[model samples]
Target chain A: MSAPMDKPESSRRQFFNGTVRGAFLFLLGAATTLLFRRSQPKRTVWQIDPYKCICCTNCATKCVMHPSAVKCVQVYPMCGYCKLCTGYFEPEPISLDTGAENQLCPTGAIKRRQLEDPYYEYNIDEPLCIGCAKCVKGCVLFGNGSFFLQVRHDRCVNCDECAIAIACPSQAFQRVPADKPYLFKNREHQA
Target chain B: MRRMLRACLYLTLLSLPLVAAFGVERFPPPEFDAGYKMPVTTMPPARALWLSYVDVAVLVAALALASYLVLKKRSRDGVLALSVFSLLYFGFYQQGCVCSIGSVQDVALALFNSGYVVPLTTVAFFLLPLLFTLFFGRTFCSGVCPMGAMQDLVLLKPVKVPAWLEHALGTLPFVYLGAGILFAATGSLFIICEYDPFVALYRRTGSFGMLALGAAFLIVGIFVGRPYCRFLCPYGALLSLVSRFSKWGVTLSPTDCIHCQICDTACPYGAIADPMLKDPHPDPRKRARRRLALLALTALLVVLGGWLGERLSVPFSNSHATVSLAEQIAAEDAGKIKEPTDASKAFRQTGQPVEELYAEAHRVRGRFAVGSVLFGAFVGLVFGLTLISVSEPHERNVYDPDPADCVSCGRCYVYCPKEIVRVKRIQGKNVIPLTPVRGEQKG
Candidate 1:
C-alpha cells in the first residue's frame, strides 16, 4: 500500500505542538521562580512548642513511627531537683521511692538518683520513653514545667506533614530551624 | 551489663541541674559544696541540609537516565534495572516522605497560603518530573517514580480491563487531585499524604488501616498492572496531561510499520494504538452537527456540575478539623451529645470565645464552597472532553503508542520483528528471511 501523505496537516500539528510546549514551559518556569522566592532559606523540621503543648498524649499514638519520635526532654536548668518530683512519681504514690508502680512513666523511663540530701536527679531513658507525655502533664500542673515533649531529630524521619502535629488538639506543632530542632522550656524562659 | 552501667554513669554525669532560676521556682535546688559542672542538654543533629540537595541531584540524574533508556536505548532491561534502583533509594531508603506524589499538597499549600513556605527540595521534586514529561513522555513513570516501580514489580499476571470500565475508573485520579489541592489550599489537611498507600509499606510502620490498604493495592497489582499509576496517582494524572504534548516518546517499531500486530499484545497498559483506514464514503455534515451538539452538552455539564458541588460544600467542609470542632461544640451545647469529645474538651479548656470558633469555621466553609464548585466544574470538563474524544473517529494510518497512556516502559520494542533484525545485524549474525507484508507478494 502507498503511504498516506498529509503534509499540510503534519505541519499544522507541529506548529500547534510547538506553541503548546512553549506555553507550558513558560508556565512551569513562572511557577518554579515564584515557589523558589517564597521558599525559606533555612530548612525547617517539625517541632512541638512546649508552651502551647497541653500534653494530651496524642504524640505517643499518632506518630507514623511506632514508639513515636516525640520524647520527653528534661530542661536541667529549670528543674527544681525536688525529692518529691511530680514528673517521676504518680499522684498519691504509695511511697516517695523509685518503684515501677510509683513512677508516672509507663515504660519506667524516668530514673531517679540521689544527688545530695533531699535532692534527686531524674533522667529520661530515651529508648524506653514512649512519648506518652503523662509525666509532662504532672510536671506542668503540679511542679516546675521542666519536662516537655520534643521531636528528637535522630529518630524522627521528619515527614513533610507530621502525623502527631495533625492529631494535636492544641496546635502545638511548629516548624523550627533544623539547626535548632528542639524547643526547650528553659530556652523559652531565657528568651 | 557493663554497657548498661556505662549508660547509667553517663546519664548521671549529664544530669547536673544548674540553678539558673528563670521560671517560677516552687522548690529551690540544693547547693553543693563541691564544684559540680553543669552539663549542657545535648540534641541530636538534624539530617544534614546538604543531603537534601543530594536527593535533588539523584532525582535529576535518574530522570535524565530514564529518558535516555526509554528513547535512545529502548531497552526494557535498563528500565527495569533503573526502576529497581528507584524502589530501593526513593521508596525504602528515603522511606517515601516528600515524594513527588505527596509534594502536590506542599506546592498547593505554598501557592494558596502565604504563611506556609515549601522547602526547596520539595519544589524540585514537584516540578522535575513534569519538566521531563514535557520533553520526553513519562519517563518518570517508567523508571523513576518509586510508587510506580513498586506496582510495576508486583505485576506478574496482567489482566486486560474492558475499555468502558477503564475509562470510568480513569476519572478517579482527577477527582483525587482536585480534593487534594482543595484541602491543601484551605490549610485544612494534606489528604494525599495522609492516605498514601505505599508509605506505610516503605516505612514498615504505620496505622493498621494504611498497611491493609497498601497490601490490598499490592495484591490487586499482582493481577493488574500499575493499578495506582493508572487510576489513583494524582501526580500521574498531571504527568499524563503533560505527556500528551511530549516532543518525543517510545515508538513500537524501529522502521516503518510492517503490520505484525505483535506489539498489540506486548503492552500491558494497552497503550498501543492500531491503524485506522479512512472510510470510502464520508458525510461531513453529520460529523460537524454531532461535534457541535457535543460541545453544547459539555457546556451544560459544567454548569450542572458546579451547582451540584455547591450543594456538597457542607458535607465536604466537615472534613476540616475546625469546622468539625465547631459542630461538636454546638452539638454538646444543644444536648445532642451528653459528653464532650477530647477535642471539644480541649477547646473548652483554651477559654477561647465560642463565637470566634464558629466564625472561623464559617470562613473555612465559605472557602470550601468556592473550592468545591471549581473542583466539580473541572471534573465535568474532563468527563465531557473524554466523551467527545471517545466519539471521534481515529485518523491514524500507522500503529503507534498512545501518547497520554504510554509510560515509555520500552516493552513493545522487543515485540517488533524489525527491532530483532536490527539487533541481529549489529551482532553480525546470519540474516533471516524478511516476513512478507499482508496482501503483498514476496519476491
Candidate 2:
C-alpha cells in the first residue's frame, strides 16, 4: 500500500507542474499585452527629407530594386516648360535630334515633344525616370525650378512611422497633415 | 478575475472617443502629430558607445544574478532576489517601450523591406535578447518584462488549468511567429508595433477597459501563472521554439525531486519542471506527430491571416502609396480640395488635401483592425495549444541552452531542480547577471 501511494503522489506532483507551466505562459502573454498598452502619444514611425539631395546620378545605381522607386519630378508651374530646354539635353545640340542616344536622359525618361515650331515641350516619363535628378540638377542650375525630386507618397508604404525621415541626408522632409499629407512648396527656395 | 479585467480593458478602449472629446481644439489634434519618435533614433557613435557600455554591463550582471538566484535552493534570500530581478526586468521593458522580440521583429522586417531600414538602435534592441539567452533561460519574459512584473505583483494565488487546454494553446505562438515574419516580410504590416497592449498599461492613460484588462491579468496571473507568455504573445511563441532546440539551458539536479509542488506553487511565473518522474527523453513519435500537426496548422493560419489583412487593407493601401503631389499638380494654376470635407477639422490645415486626410484616417483604422485580429488569433493559439500540450515535462536535465530564444528570462535557471549550480565566469569585465541580487530589497 505504501509503495503504490508513492507512485500516485509523484504523478500528482507532475500534474501540478504541468498545469502551472501552462498558466504561466497564458499570463505572460496577457501581461505583455497589457503592459505594452500603456499611454503613449502617437509615435510617428516614418519620415523622409528633400533638401540635401544633390541630384546625384546614383539613384539609378544605388537602388537594389528594379525601376528604382525613386523618380524625377517637375514643378510644372515653376517649369519654363522650355521649348529648347537645356535640362533635357546639351544646350547647343548640333542638330535637333530626339533619338535616344542624343537625348540628355540616359534612361530616355525625358520626352521632348514639339509644343510649337520654336517652343518645343519637355515632359518626364516617370516610369523610366530614375530620380538620378540629372535633369533636376540641370533645370535647377540653368532654368526655372521646373524639375525637382519629390517622393510619390502614393508609392510609399508609409509604415506606422516613417523610416526615410531618419535616413534622409537633407532635413527637407517635414510631417505634413496626415489628412492632407503633402505640403508642396511651389514657392522659390527661401534663404 | 480575468473576465473583469478584460471588460475593463475593452471598456477603456471603447472610451477613446470620450478622451478625444476632451481633446483641445487645436488644428492638428495632438494625437495626430505630437508623440515621441522611436528613441532608438538619433543614435550616433558617442551615444552608441555610452549606451553599449551601460547596456552590456547591466545586462550581463542581471543575467548572472537571475540564473544564480533561480537555481539556488528555495531560501528566503533566493526568493527575494528572484522577485526583484524579475520586476526590474519588467520595469526596463516598460521604459524601453518595446520588448526584445517586438524590437527584433521590427528591425528585421525593416531591413528586409527595400522601402526602408530601421535605425541602428533597433539593431541593438534585437540583439540584446540573444546574447543574454545564451547563458540564461528566457529572462525576458520572467525578469526583464514589465508585463511579467505586473503579473508577478498581482498574482495573489494561482489556478490550475486542464492539460487539454494547455496543449491546444501551446501552438499559437509559433503560428504568430510565422505569421508575423511573413506579413512583415511582405511589407503588408508591422504587426508587432500595432498591437502591444502593455504599452497602454505603463502609460496609465490607456482606455479603462485596457487598464481593467491589465488589472485583471495581474490578478489572474497569481492563480494561473505566466498566462500572458504562455498564451498570447507571438514573440513568446517564437522564443519557445528557439529555446526548445537550444544547446544549453536550465536543468534538473541528479537527485530525487521530493514530490513537492512547492516550486510549482511558489513560481509566480510558473516555469518549473519537476525533477522527479520526468522523462529524460520526450516520446519522439509524439513530438514528430505534433510537429507535423503544427506545420499544417501554421499554414492554415498564415494564409487566412494574409488574405484577411489584404481584404481589410484595400481602402487605405491605394491612397497611402507615395507619389509626388507637387509634380502631379505642376500644371494646376490653383489648388482645391481633391476630396471634400471641411478643412476646418482637426489637423486639416486650411489648404490640406481631403483625399490625404481621408487616407490617413483609413490607414489608422485599417491597421488597427488587422493588427487586432492577428494578435487576437495569436493569443488564442498560444493559450489553447499550451493547455492541450501540457504534460509531465520530461526529466531532461537542461532547458533550452542557446543564445537565441532564451531572452534570459531566468525562469528555467531559478526554478531549475538542479542541486549543482554553474558559477559563470567573466574576464576583464564585470558582467551583470540577468538575475537579481537576492539580498538587496528596494523600496
Candidate 3:
C-alpha cells in the first residue's frame, strides 16, 4: 500500500508551507474583519433619487401594492410658488380653477389653495394619490421640480426585492439609511 | 438501469413537441369593447415577516442537512434528495430573491458606500456559505446552492475539460469576481446578479436575451457539467479560496482505497487527483530559476494590466448613467448632436446647471479609473497564480480529492469498494477481503 501519511517534510519546506498558510489566514481574517467593520446596525430601505427619476409612470403599475407606496413629495424651498403652477394645472386648462378636468393630477390628489397674490400652494392627498408622476413630470418639465416621488415607509411593505425598483426605467431607486430615509434633492447638489 | 434508460427516452420523446411549442405565439388578438372597464389593481396580500423568517430557517436547516449528508452519511442519494429539495424550495418556491450568490454585490456596494446599509439577512446570506466552506470544505456547493443544484440535475454527460483549456478558462471566475466587485464598489452595476442565468427561470419572466442565455447555459450544462459554477460564478471562486484552507475535506472511501479507479470515473466535476509518483528529473536549481523567472513575468503583467485598465476607464465609465449623460451633454454643447434622450430631457427640465452634472460625472469617472486599475491588478494576480499552479507538481501519497475543485457531491461514495464493504458489513452479509494493488498504480 502507498504511504497513508504524507512524506516527512524538510524544515525549509515546512517553513514555506507555514508561511503560505499564514498568508491565506491573514487574508481571510482581513476580509471578515473589514466586512464586520463596515456593517451597519440597521438596514436601509428603498428610496428614489428625485434628480435621477424621469417621472416614469411605472410606479403606478409595477408595484405589487395597489396604489404603490411611491408618493409625490414637494420640497417647498425649491417651489417657485407660481399662480399658474404647471404641476397643478393642465397644459391647456379652461381656467385657473381647481376643477378635476383643469388639474394635471388625474386623481385630484393635489389640493390647490391661494397662499398669496399670484402664488398658490398644492398639497398631495396621500390616500387619493396614485403615484402616476404626472404632476412630477409637469413640474420637472416647466417649473423648479419641487414635486418628486418617494417611497412612503408607512405604505411600503418592505419587500426584500422591490418590484418598482426592478422595473424602474431610469434606475432611480436606491437604498437609503432608515434613519435618514428620503433622498431629497437640494438646490445645491445633484443626485 | 436499462428500464430506467428506456423510460427517460420515452419521456424525452413525449416532451419534444412541448419544447418546440415555446417558440410559437399562441395568443390571439384582443377585441376592443367600448364599455370595457379597467381592472382594479388590487394588492396581493403581503407576505408576513414571519414567512420571511421561515424562509431563513428553511435555508439554515437545508444547509445543515446538506453538510451532515456530505460529511457523515456520505450518501449520493441523500445529496441528490437534498439538491432536489433545495431546488424546489429556493429556486421555484422562493423565486430566487435574496440569494447568497447575488448578496456578494450587495456586500461589496455596502463596503464602498458607508451611507448604504446592507440588510442584516443579506450579510448572513453572504457569510454563512463561506464560513461553512471554511470548516467543512464545499458542503454548501454540494447541494445547498440552488444554482449549483439546478446545474447538477442537468449534467447528463460531463466531459472532462482538456487540462490546458481548463487551466486557462479557470482564471475567468477570478476576473469575473474582480469585475463584480469593482462595478458594485463604484456603484456602476451588479454584473453578477444582472447576468444571472437561472434567476429568470425562477422568476418566470425576464428579458428575451436573459431567457435565451439561461436556455443556452442549461444546454451546455448537459455536457459541460455546471458551466457557470466552474467558469463564471464569482461566489464559487470565493468559496474555492476558503475551501482551500478548510479544516476538513472529502474522503473517497470509508476504510481504505483499493485503487479500483471507479471513484475517479464517478466524479462528475473531475476533482479527483491521482496518487502522485516520484518525478525522475535532475537540476532542482534550474527548476527554481524557472519559477523565479515566471514570478518576475507575473509582476510585469500586473503592471501592464493596471496601466491598460486606467487607459480604458473613459469608455468603461460610460456604463454609468452620469458619465453617459455628461458625454451626451458635451456632444450637444459642441453642436455635434441635436437629439435629446428621455434622460437628457429630464435633466434639462430639472434645471440643474450643466457644470454640476459634468463635475459629478468627472468624479464618478475618477472613481472608476481607480477601481478598474485595482480590478485589473487583481485579475493579473489571479492569472499569474493560475499559471504558476498549473505547472506545480503534487506529491500526494493517496488518490485524494482536490480541495479547491471538489464540491462534496458524494458520487465517489457510490463507486468506492471500501464503502461497499462497510455497507455490506452493516447489512450482516458475507463479504470478501480484497488486497489493494501497489504495482498497478498509474503514474
Greater DockQ among 2 and 3 belongs to 3
Best model number under lDDT = 1
Q: True interface contacts reproduced by each model, as a fraction?
A: 0.46, 0.00, 0.07
| TM, every model | 0.87, 0.45, 0.71
Best by DockQ: 1
What is candidate 1's DockQ? 0.38
lDDT of 1 by residue, B279-368 (tens): 432788888888899999888888878988898989989988899999999999999999877688779877899999999999999999
Better of 1 and 3 by lDDT: 1
Model 3 fnat? 0.07
Q: Give interface RMSD, per candidate.
A: 7.5, 21.7, 18.8
Clashing pairs in 3: none
Model 2: DockQ against the native? 0.02
Query: What is model 3's interface RMSD?
Result: 18.8
Error of 3 at B222 (Å): 1.0
TM-score of chain B of each: 0.87, 0.54, 0.86
Question: What DockQ do you compute for every candidate structure?
Answer: 0.38, 0.02, 0.05
Write one digit per residue (lDDT tens) for candidate 2, span B1-443: 53354335434544444322111111111121334221111111112224434554555565555555443332335534555664554343334343565664664355445444443334444555544443344555545555655665565666656545655555655665655664554444455544554544555444455457667666667787667677667667655654553323444332344433433443444355434345433788886776677666655665665565555544423322221222223213245534322112222223467577455555545554565456445544544444334432443342222232223334333443222132232133345443442212110
Q: Model 1: runs farther than 4 Å from truth?
A: A1-9, A81-84, A94-101, A113-119, A187-191, B1-24, B32-40, B276-293, B331-338, B341-355, B426-430, B433-443
> Per-model TM-score of chain A alone?
0.83, 0.64, 0.77
Residue A132 in candidate 2, Cα distance off native in Å: 39
Residue B368 displacement in candidate 3 (angstroms): 1.3
